[model samples]
Target chain A: MAFPDRFDGLPAAPRCEGVYKVTGDTRGNNVAIDVLGVTKVFGAADSGFRALDKVSASIRQNEFFTLLGPSGCGKTTLLRLIAGFEFPTEGRILLDGEDIAALPPFRRPVNTVFQSYALFPHLTVAKNISFGLEMLGWPATKIASTVERMLALVKMEPMADRLTDQISGGQQQRVALARALAPNPRVLLLDEPLSALDFKLRKEMQIELKRLQGETGITFVFVTHDQEEALTMSDRIAVMSAGRILQVGSPREIYDRPTERFVADFIGETNFLEGEAKVAGDRLLEVRLDAGATVKATAPDAALHAGRTTVAVRPEHADLVPGDGPADLTGVLKNIVYFGTDTHFHMTLDNGVPFIVRQQNTPGEGSGFSIGEQVGVRLHADAAQALKD
Target chain B: MQPHEVEQAAIRRGTMRRWLLSAPALVIIFLASFGPLFVMLAFSVLEKGDYGGVKPWTFSFDGWANVFFQHDIFTGELGFADAHLSIFWRSVRLSIITTALTLVLGFPTAYFIATRPRKTREIWVFLVTIPFWTNLLIRTFAMQEVIRNEGVINTVAMRLGMISEPIQIMYTDWAVLFGMTYVYLPLMVLPLYASMEKLDFRLVEAAYDLYANRFKVLRRIILPLTKPGIIAGSILVFIPSLGAYVTPRVLGGGKNMMLGNLIGLQFGKGNNWPLGAAISITLMVVVMVALLVYVRATARAGGDDRGR
Candidate 1:
C-alpha cells in the first residue's frame, strides 16, 4: 500500500517527540513497561481499599500479554496505572528506561480501548481517529493522510463520515481501536474491550486483536475475566486475585504446571483432590488422598516446600474401567452426562469424594457403566501435578 | 369493510386519539401566550390617550414611531430620542455580558459537580439549587445588603482597616450587572450540570490517553459534547436578564433602567400607554431576533458535527 511510504520510512507507529523518545534501550529496558512493586490504594491512606498490592511484572515489547482474573481482582487497576489514568501509591512505572510515574496520561506514549468503547459522539469516525494527531499539532496534510490510513486499517472506510453513535456496538469498538492506535502509542491497554460483544463476535474479535497486535508491533496489555480468551490470545497470562498476582506464565505452563491451587482452579476445568504429599523421589511425590487412595504425582518446581499438597487432574485425563481392571483408584458410578463431543462420568470415590472423568464419544466403543455400580478408574501417567495450598 | 381497510381505520383512530390527547395543551398555549400578544400588537398601532389609556379605534402611526422618535417640545419636530436607544443598548449589553459571565462561572462548577463521586454529586447539585428555594427578590435584596456602600462589604472592609472610605458600588452598571449575574447563575448551572452529568468521562480519559492535555480535552471533547447545555443555559439566563426590572430597580437606584423598567415608566408617569405597548412588542421582536441567532448558531454547529 501507499500508506507505508507516506509515514516516510519511520515504521508502523509514529514517534511523537515529547510523548516518547527514541533513545536506544539499555540497562535491561527491553521490557516495554516495567512495573515495580506498585501499590494503589483508594479513598484513605490508612484504611483504603487496596486495589493493587505491591504488584510487579514486566511486559515485553510487542507481546500480547493478558491479566486474567475474576471481577474486582485489580487487573483493571494495573492497566489504569500503566496508562497513567491512576497513579500508584508507591513504587514506580517505567516505560522503556525512564520513570513515568509522575507523568499525566497525555504525556505517556500509551492509549487505552476502554471497556465501553468510549467513542466521541460529537465527531465523525474520521475525526475521532484524527483527534490524537491533531492534538500533537501534526500538519493538516499529515493528519488527513494518517486518518485515511487508519480508516483503511480498521476496514471502516465507508463509515468515515458517520457519527459514532450512528454505528453498531461492534463498529464503535473498531473505531475506538483505530482512534487509539492512530497516534502510534508504544503500548495499548485494553480493559475488557471485547466483554460487551456476543459470543460469536467476541471470538471473531479475539482473532482480529491478535492479528492487529502482530501487524502493529505495539505491546498489548489485555485485561479479561475469560480464561479461554487469555489462553487463546495471550503470549503470557498473569493470574490475579484479591489485589495480588497469583501466577504468571505461558498458557500451556499455566494450564499444565499451576503452582497455586487458585491458578489451577481458575485457568481451566479441573478436579481438585486434597492429598498429603511425601517425597518419593526427585521430581516426584507420592500423594495420599483423603479418599484413601495413593497416587503418584509430579512435583511442581516452586511448590516443593514442606506443606500440604493438592493434586489437580484435568477431567479428560482419566478413563472409566467398568467392573474391574488394572486401576489405581476405585469409585461407585453415580451418573453420566453427555456433551456433544464428549461424555462425562460422574462418580464418587470410596470415601464419598467427587470424581469426574471425561471421555470423547468414540464411534462403536459400546462401553457403558450403569449407575449404582462400583467402577475402577485409571489415571494416565504424568496427568497429576502437586499444587501448593 | 375489506381487511386492509379495517386496519387503516384502526391506524386513523390511533392518530386521532393522539391529537385529541394533545388538544388541551395546544389550546392553553394559544390562549395564554398569543392572546395577550395579539392585544399588545393592536394597542401598539393605536394613538396615545390624554388620560393614561389607549384611544381605542384611533388609527395612528405615532405610537410605533415614538419608539424610535419623539416630538421636540421647543421645535415641534420629530427627532431621535437617544435616551430610549441608550436604555435599549444597556439592556442588550448587560444581558449579553450577564450570559457570558454566568457561563464563565458555571462551566467549571458544573464540571466539578459532574466529576465528583456519584453519591456526593447529588449533594453538590442540591447546594447549587439552594438559591432557587428562596424568592428571587429576597436573594437580590440579600445581595444588595452585601455589595452596597455602608453595607456588609464596606463595613467589614472598613473595620478590618482595609480602606478609609466606602467604595461606591451601589448605583452603577456594575451593581446591575453583578445582581443580574448572581440571580441568573443557577439557570446556567442546571442545564450545564445535566449535560455534564450524562457525559461519558471515559471519553475524557480516552482523550487524555490519546495525547490530549486538560486544555485540549476541554476544547475538543468536553465543550462540543456539552454544547446543547451551553445553548439551553445561555437562553435561560439571557432572556430573563434582557427584561429584568426588579434587580435593576432594587440595586441600580433609579438612574440605570432596563427595558422592563422603561416600559413601566411609559404606562405610569409618562401617560403614554400606546408607546408602552409599542415598546413591549419591540422587546418581543428583539427576543425573537436573538432566538433566531441562537438557532442559527446551533444549526451551524449541528451541520459541522455531521461532517459534510
Candidate 2:
C-alpha cells in the first residue's frame, strides 16, 4: 500500500495497512549508529523471549538521545546490542557506516556506564578511570595525564586515591562517568546511571551529564525508564512499548503532540474521551463526545474520517468558567485540591465522566466556587488530539 | 539500691548469664584439645623407659637432641645426623606439590561450575561433592587399583601399544602425591566456587567495554577478586597433606617416609616414645608458623582494602 508522507526519521507503522504521518523537519542527518532492522531473541528456539522485533533507528552524532520505555520493553537490549555485549539474531548494527554487529565488545569503540555503576571495588578511583586507557596499551605517562584530566572533569580530584567502596554513591557515579568518558569513545551508552542516586543528587547529575555531553561533543545513547529524566535531559526521545518504537520526537513535540495513546499516557497524564471524529475543513477536525458535545481540534494530516476515535486532552489545558458562560461541557464541582503552585478542580461531567481542570493560583484568585456547585469547562482549539482507537 | 549500683548489678547478672550459656561448648573444646596436648608436652621431656613407656620421675633433653643428632647408646655421645631432617623436608615438599596440583585443577573446575546456568550449576556442584559420599580410605584403595603394576591403566596402556611393559607407578612418591591431590581436590574447589559464585559478572562486561580482552580480563579482574578463596583452599589442602599418614603408608610403600610415618614409627616399632612426642611437637610448631604467616598476609590484605 502507498503510505502517507511520514515525517523524517519516523519509525514504521505498527500495522501494514496504512500510516497517519506527521510532518516535520528531519533529525540527525549525520548518523552515528544505524540500527537497521535488528531483531534479538534470547534462549533456545523452542522456548525463548523475543526481546526486540524488527527494531530500527538512527542515532545522530553529538546528540543526547534516549530510548525511553517501561521495564522489559527491549530498550536495554537495544543498548546492549549497540555496546556489543549482545548481537542481534537478525539484521545489522552499523557504527560510522561500518557493520559492527559481529564485532566483540572489546573491539567496539563504545563504552557504557552500567546501571549498578559496576565499579571495581578492588581498584581506586584513579585506577578505574585509567583502566580503559591502559587497555588500549597507552603509555604510563599518558594514562596518568588522562586520569588526571578525567578527575578534574568530574571534580573528583580529592577522591582519586580512595577505593570505590569508600566513596559515597554520588562520588561513585561521577567516577563511573569519568571512566566511561576517559577513552573519548565515539559514542557512550548509559543504563539508568542516576537511578541509584537520591532525588536531589539525580537532579544535579542530570544537568551535569548534559553539560558533560556538550563539552565532549560525543554521541550519547541513554536508556531509562523514567519519562521525566528523558524529557529533562534528552535532545530527542524515542518512546517504546512491547518491543516497538511507538514514536520519536523532541521533548516538546512528544509532550505537546503525542500521536500514540501509550505515548500520551506514559509521558504525562491525559484524559481519553471517547468520540466519533469527522473532518470539518482543511487542517480542521471535530470530535463529538458521547455526551453530545462537539470539540474542535486540528489534525496533523488528512487521516481523520467519520469513525470512532479517542480525543486526548491534558488536564491543564481545560479552563474553568462561570456556570452561566458558554462552555462545551458542564459538570458539578466535586472537590478542590490546593497544590502549592496550582489548584485542581475535580468535577463529574453530565455524562458521568470524571473531569479535572488544573489552574495556576494567582495571588488574588480566591476559591470562588464552592464544592457541589455547577461549573463550565472550556477547551482550546489546539488542545485536543484525535487518536486512532 | 541507687540507680547506678542497680545498673551495675544488672550488667554483672547479664554477663554471668551469657557465660553460663556458652560454658558447655568452651569446656568441651578445652578438654578435647589441651588435655592431650599437655600429656604430649610432658611425654616429650621425660626419660624413655625400657618397655615403650615414659619414666615419670626422670627429666631429660635427649629426646629433642635425638631429632637432629645421633647418640652412641653405649658412649652417650651426640653427633649430627640428617636422616630425620630429610624426612621433614620430604613432608614439606610433598605438601607443597599436592597444594599446587589441587589449586591448578580446582580453579578451572570451580570456574566452569560457577559460570553455568542456575539449574545446571546446582547439578555441577552436587557432582563435585559426590566423592565425599564414600569413605576416603576406600577411595584411596580404589586409586591403588588404577595405578598398580597389573592395574586397569597398565592393561589399557598395553593394549593400546603405548608401552611394551607396565609402568611402575605405584610404590613411589608420585603415587603418594597423586593420591593426596585426589583426596583433597574437593576441599579446594568448594571454597573457590563459593567465592566465584559471589563475583559480579557485570565487572567483566565493563572490562570488555574498556577494551580488555579475555586474558587481561581474567588476570586483572577474575583472578585478583578470587584471591581470598585461593588462599583459603590452599591452606585446607596444604595442612592436611603435610600430616598425611595413610596415603604415604599405602602408596609410598614405606620407601619414602613422611613426618607422619616417621613419627608413627618412633612410637611403634622404633620404641622411642620421647622422640615421637618431640617430633609431634616440632610438626605442630611448623604448622603453627604456616598458619601465622597466612594470618599476617590476610591481615595486610584486609588493612590495605580498608585504605590504611
> Per-candidate RMSD vs. true structure?
3.7, 7.0
The candidate maximizing TM-score is 1
lDDT string for model 1 (B84-192, tens) is 9999999999999999999999999999999999999999989998988999899988989999887999999999999999999998999999999999998999999
**Residue range with the least summed lDDT across 10 consecutive positions in model 1 chain B:** B299-308
lDDT of 2 by residue, A284-327 (tens): 67888985579876555633667787778888998998779989
The true-versus-predicted C-alpha distance at residue B252 of model 1, in Å, is 1.9
Model 1 steric clash pairs: none
Most lDDT-accurate candidate: 1
Give the count of colliding residue pairs in each prediction.
0, 0
Q: TM-scores across all candidates?
A: 0.94, 0.91
